[model samples]
Target chain A: MDLQVAIDRVTLDKAIDLAKQLDTQVDVIEFGTSLIKDYGLEQIHAQLPKLQHAKLLLDLKTIDEGEYEFDKGFATGDILTAMGAASADTLTKVYALSQSRGKQLFIDMMEITADKTAQIVNHPAAIYGIHHAKDSKAGFDAAATVAAFHEDYPMVQHISVAGGIDLTMAQKLATQGIAESVIVGSAIVKTADPVAAAQKFMEVMHK
Target chain B: MDLQVAIDRVTLDKAIDLAKQLDTQVDVIEFGTSLIKDYGLEQIHAQLPKLQHAKLLLDLKTIDEGEYEFDKGFATGDILTAMGAASADTLTKVYALSQSRGKQLFIDMMEITADKTAQIVNHPAAIYGIHHAKDSKAGFDAAATVAAFHEDYPMVQHISVAGGIDLTMAQKLATQGIAESVIVGSAIVKTADPVAAAQKFMEVMHK
Candidate 1:
């Protein structure tokens, strides 16, 4: 499993610094939704060149106006996300745009039911992100969730799981060999040493 | 009924200029999702002082991490929006935050089922936004949709409707007396004379 270190709720400068430091250690570097809404895409685009090694994923969390957000988002990042709850038309348009541009679309399956997920899972090129809402009081079992998701939708190839991921969970998910990537947010970015935290997660995943 | 003129897909300068001109004419001035993503909130916050009249609504369309997005959004906007499709915990956090600050939260009800709406529509102070996805090719009858929504969820006190609202549709919605506000986007902003177009819609709604 690839380690996708998410940078969130920090100043853009700090986020950039962390991204640069963690680029070589992780497979993908994510600028969370907080950075996008707090800082804006134009400014984020200007500062995107700071990272040289890792792929950049901007959590746009686009629900509507898919073409417009994707068009602007692709200018900076390698991957952009759209909410799975968005209408089929929105998903279809964004998926087409991402494919045409040779970029990737990550479909955020947050707060969506299995019935809805079945309708939108046909996009083979898009990454189906199994996101746990940050505000949920319930505990998340990342490995179990991925296993269930994989069982439910055997056709889904590119699966990414996120929310409250720790080193143990990362290793478990790696062993399961189902998820394409695991997204770590505060576990890496909020620690005293983000680079070290990321390397630790990377080491566990690879081992 | 209140009229909300949405400023979208325009340069920040033009949006500010239009907001300044329409501030006195409309009940609310909205910085659409496009503007927020394009310019960033800090930059938009810097320019928000120009509006001398009308409440500002930032369409944050927040799907997760409610508290963080709401805290930042409420800095400049009188009202901020969260996706109705968001987890109950997220909606709850944002709703409480908006209430604590005495700001308003608009829940964007896009692509959500009536069952889900039943779960999240208890916040009386929160405006339940009846939105049509921009990507959908289906025709939208704003007045009819609002009437049906009101009938289905009679407990939902505050209702706001958007999507291709024209002069006739605005007049119909105003007469229907179900919606608290009507949101107009390209119809008003894309016209050659945005100010005059806004005035015309205002006149129709009042009449």
Candidate 2:
């Protein structure tokens, strides 16, 4: 499994610094929804330097105006996310746009019901992100969540699991072979040395 | 009935100019989701002058990170919107935050199923906005939609309807007396004179 380190709720300068430091250590560097909504795609595009090693993902969490958000988001990041709860038309439009532009769309599956999930699983190329809401006080079991989701929809090829992913859970997910990528936020970014933290997670996943 | 004018897909300068002009004419001046994502709440907060007459509503469409988004959103806008499809926990957290601050929360009920709607209809102070996804090519009948919604969820007060609301539709909604507010976007803002168009909408609603 690939380690996707998410940088969130931090200043742009700090986010850029962390991204630069963790670029080589992780497979994908996500500028979290907080970063995108706080600074915007235009400002982020203007400020953030191009990454040399890792892929860039911006958690746009787009629910409506899919084309407009995706059009601007693609200018900066390699992958942009849209909410799975969005209408089929919105999802279809953005997925097609991603394909046409040779970029990727990550469908953020947060608070989406199983019935809704089953219907929107037709995007073969799009990454189906099983996200846990950050604001929820409830406990999240990343591995079990991924396991259940995979069992429910084995057809979804590019699966990614996010929210409260620690080293142990990361290793378990990597071993399970369901999710292609595991997204780590505070565990990696909030550490004393994000680069070192990311390396450790990567080490565990690879081992 | 209240007229909520939505300013979207424009430069920040244009948005501010339009907001300034429409401040007194409309009951509420909405800086749509486009404005918040394009310019950001912080930048908007710093730039936008306090509205002298109309209440400000920023369509944050916040799906997660409720407290963080609401804290920043309430700094500038009298009302902030959250997606109705968000987790129940997220909705509760933001609702409490809004209540604590004595501001309002507008729940954008776009693509939310009837079952989900029944679950989240408890926030009496929160305006339940019956929104049609702009990305969808499906035609919308604003008054009919609001009436149907009201019939289904009679307990839900402070209903706000949006999506392709023209003069006739606005008049019909006003007469129906179910929706307290009708949100008009391009019908007003895309006109030669936005302020004049807003007056025409207000006239129709009042008549």
Off by more than 4 A, model 1: A132-140, B132-140
When summed lDDT is taken over every stretch of 10 residues in candidate 1 chain A, the lowest stretch is A131-140
* lDDT by residue (tens digit), candidate 1, A64-148: 9999999999999999999999999899999999999999999999889888999999999999999643444455477778888
lDDT of 1 by residue, B1-207 (tens): 999999999999999888988999999999999999988899999876756779999999998889988899888999999999999889999999999999999999989987899999889899999964344546547777888898899999899998888899899999989999999989988989998999999999998
Candidates' chain B TM-scores in the order shown: 0.94, 0.95
Global local distance difference test of model 2 = 0.89
Worst 10 residues of 1 chain B by lDDT: B131-140
**Interface DockQ per candidate:** 0.86, 0.66
Give the Å shift of residue B143 in candidate 1.
Answer: 1.6
Query: Tens digit of lDDT per residue, candidate 2, span A11-36?
Result: 98899999889888889999988887
TM for candidate 2 is 0.95
B131 Cα displacement, candidate 2 (Å): 2.8
Task: Quote the TM-score that chain A achieves in each candidate.
Answer: 0.94, 0.94
The DockQ score of candidate 2 comes to 0.66
